[model samples]
Target chain A: MKDRVTTPLGAVTLLLLLVAVGLGLSSPLDVNQGSLVRLMFVHVPTAWVSYLAYGGTGLFGLLYLITRKRRWDRLAMASGELGVLFTVATIVGGMLWAKPTWGTYWVWDARLTTTALSLVVYGGYLLIRAMIDDPERRARVSAVVGIVGTLYVPINYMAVEWWRGVHQTQTLKLLGKVRFDAAPIYGWVLLIATAAFTLLYIYLLRVRGIVAARDEAREERELMNDLQGDLNSLTPQGGLRG
Target chain B: MDKYAVYVIVVYVVTLLLLGAYLVWLAQRLRATRNEAGLTEQVRATSTPGNQTSSRQTPGKRG
Candidate 1:
């Protein structure tokens, strides 16, 4: 049978995801919010993963530029794309929950605005990559953008606490004192969701790497073919007919 | 399940659909890349005239 945990990294990630889901599902729902609070199981973890993925992209971007490794650039691009997806999910989930709780679909809160800004910055990073034609140049420019865009993740997270914002403060923080009774099953569900999403992320990253490798090989072949054609056309008759 | 049940269901469904679509796209891409890699290998093998004889003579070491 194929190894379910093929790599050490995969095994460790799977374990952590299982733990996270277990913790999330087992934790009882807040007495105030009822079962709807269970959405936090998916939302909070996805938001965390989104930041982690983007942060990873920034790091890989740095590695790509420093080492001039195409693999690093490919991984960075993949991470950023996944980050965008999770960010969208976070925003949508938050909005859906907010409409009922906050009585508004969206609020011009500091945290919300900053989070939105962070999304835009990363979106622009993708656009910059698309605009550049040369692979090396594109990688370099995107690396710079990726590194610069990461500054906003912290800002997005801390905006509510730092400023007067409509967004609520984080309850899962180490320093927070708010207490709420949570169900046991809630933690398990969260753990499961986190595991599933992390696995999905890993699977996508691997696939993206394969695609990038194929693209590089195709480009190299095309260049070689063009060069050969040019050389063939330049050669006169049989040999150098001066 | 109350008035807001529909909204919650809609959100879940939409998220699931998006995730499923992405997975399908990724699978298609993986298949395409594997196919391209196979084709490229085949072309490289056939394009080299000397390799053809060697490949036929030493089937064990071809790969």
Candidate 2:
């Protein structure tokens, strides 16, 4: 009954714009990375949101099985789809940054390889859902897959620490101390970008949910029609004659 | 400043373009699907006749 685009979605759009402006002005360009560092404003947020989105899918997948709610399944699927997009964005952005800094577009380093594997796992989840015709069965199997895929997130985070690799150490965290200077402008920018990306993710998930819900409704209608037609066929002929 | 500046800029620009295009595509698809569902619901409501009333009336028949 509510307008899908104008209410929650409008709020998200405004938040994203505010954050984008804050991030743009606050963070100084890295002395070494130069202007390329600005890309981090987008890249890091995408990566973070992708992780959050996928985690949400896993959580909803679990809840759906227990609650037996079709709505939860729909939400899980929508989140998974959005997660894949963000993951793709993260990978492409990382590769772009890598080429300039590491002198190669890709390497089989622990972090990159594990992250790629994570992407493949989620991609397989969608493929498996497509391969099944029954909605209930699809949700059950995909839920299992979603739970298993979550194990890779922690591995992806720790890949740099666990192995010697070409990937530079994480810049955002260090030995119980935040290294980056927390000047007001920089702090405000990061906060804004983070807020914006989070809203963008929510907006995307909502749109996808609406699309999925419509598809389900359409399927239900077709199924009902088919059942009715079958029933009509089975009914006795009007006349008693042969 | 660095030689790879061009590459970074190109990559960022391309990413923005791709994501922008995708969002637009999603919005269009959402509109189309909603429209299709609405039309289908209308058709079903009209074509189904008194089946709805019959179901409510025949609740005690318990097949």
Using TM-score as the measure, the top candidate is 2
Chain A fold similarity by TM-score, each prediction: 0.78, 0.87
lDDT of 2 by residue, A68-171 (tens): 89888888888888888888888898888887788898999998898888789889988888898888998898888887787777778778889979986665
Residue A2 lDDT, candidate 1, scale 0-100:
39
TM-score of each: 0.78, 0.84
Tell me, what's the RMSD of every candidate? 5.8, 6.4
Q: Among these predicted structures, which one has the highest DockQ?
A: 2
- Write out the backbone clash pairs for model 2: A19-A192, A23-A189
lDDT of 1: 0.74
Computed on C-alpha atoms, the DockQ of candidate 2 is 0.37
